[model samples]
Target: MPLLPPWFHVRLTFGDGAVVDARAVVSEGRITIGDLSAGPPAPPDGHTAPADFAGPARHRARPSWPRGREGRRLVAEAYRAAQSEGRDPVLAVMRETGRSRRRSLRLVAAARDAGLLPPRHNRH
Candidate 1:
């Protein structure tokens, strides 16, 4: 998946009495803004970010994923609730996080690995 630029909706007014409503896509240090009264901005189509943009020298690594035992506990709790309701545990995580299926599965697996969930048994 490609990293998307942040977007901001702006209404610019020039001294010449011209008003322009634009959506700005900001990536790196550059911004692209135009009359984008259209619907939502499109996915970042092949926009290449500089290598340094990913380097730790310039950018600090942010903790996007939940961390620590508490987080794992939460994931386990969600899984248990869904399983009790006869819902797909992975789907429950996906709905709660709005994350990809793979990521959600990883989260649930982590929770199980942390011993928050009972070990899976093969029930023939």
Candidate 2:
């Protein structure tokens, strides 16, 4: 039996302020977003990702830290501490990780991707 294709739930916002919330399927080197599929996806054979994937939650390699998991945990803690202490969390992550600014940013990105950290607020 053939396995079902992966499904993604997408919310696309247009320049004209129109938003479309729809589902997509990935199959046979193609991505069919919303009602554009050539055909419906096959029934699940229990080998596909969750049907609600949003196409942005794919995992990547995790950078190693000095304290291992503890050091990784510190990224969150230090960021919070910096926020409460009125310091830059990015800088604090660098200081605590003894990592460069680029690496610190990568760690932060990973945190955000993992949903462990919320997206940063933008102030005008």
Candidate 3:
């Protein structure tokens, strides 16, 4: 006789703003599953920005912060290099970090302000 495992349920939210609910039942490593959606895809949460550039823009242009897989890899490499070389870690972390200058500067500045870097003394 084959033994049966328990059922598992999951809820997922997709990038396109769709929500899905699914369930699965397993028996001896073989599984059967079913899914059902509760409602139609929902629109993004907020009001859409005006398409026209006729009026002064209300928002300022801000550089996107690196947070994805590749970005995380770059950051890790930079940090490791900085640590091994005994340099200002953020400086090494941002040098050619593949991010915009503004973002790089902000990263370095934030690290410095947070006391991650040793205080530098002015020399004549």
Candidate 4:
């Protein structure tokens, strides 16, 4: 198995030559999506400016947001399923989908906030 730095991003090539980014964990020699790999280090303070200021900057980059409603639904479903199984939804999400805790948390929170899961009173 190839060793990668926590901050390193990985792209996997399948047998058909199609490539996909590997997620948090790699199991059984298969590159799974949503692995908990480390993210890039935070930028120096000098690199950031006050939010009120508007101007062109040397380094212009923004994190990618989640996709359409379908993606959101998928995340919600995953969270609800995990919670119902008597596991930490976030941890189960990480194990099954390979997403980082941060990513899984976002999904869980979104589902909870949206009332996707049944009320606690309903669960025995």
Candidate with the greatest lDDT versus the true structure:
1
Provide the global lDDT of candidate 1 against the true structure.
0.74
Q: 49-80, model 1: which lDDT tens digit per residue? A: 45553345864444455678877887888889
Which candidate would rank higher by TM-score, 1 or 4? 1
Each prediction's number of clashing residue pairs: 0, 0, 0, 8
Best by TM-score: 1
RMSD of 2: 18.8
TM-score of each: 0.46, 0.41, 0.29, 0.35
Candidates arranged by TM-score, highest first: 1, 2, 4, 3
* Model 1 weakest lDDT span, ten residues long: 34-43
lDDT of 4 at 84: 82
What clash pairs does model 1 have?
none
Clashing pairs in 2: none
lDDT-best of 2 and 3:
2
RMSD of 3: 13.6
lDDT of each: 0.74, 0.71, 0.61, 0.58
Q: Clashing residue pairs in candidate 4, if any?
A: 23-34, 23-35, 24-34, 24-35, 24-36, 25-35, 34-98, 34-99
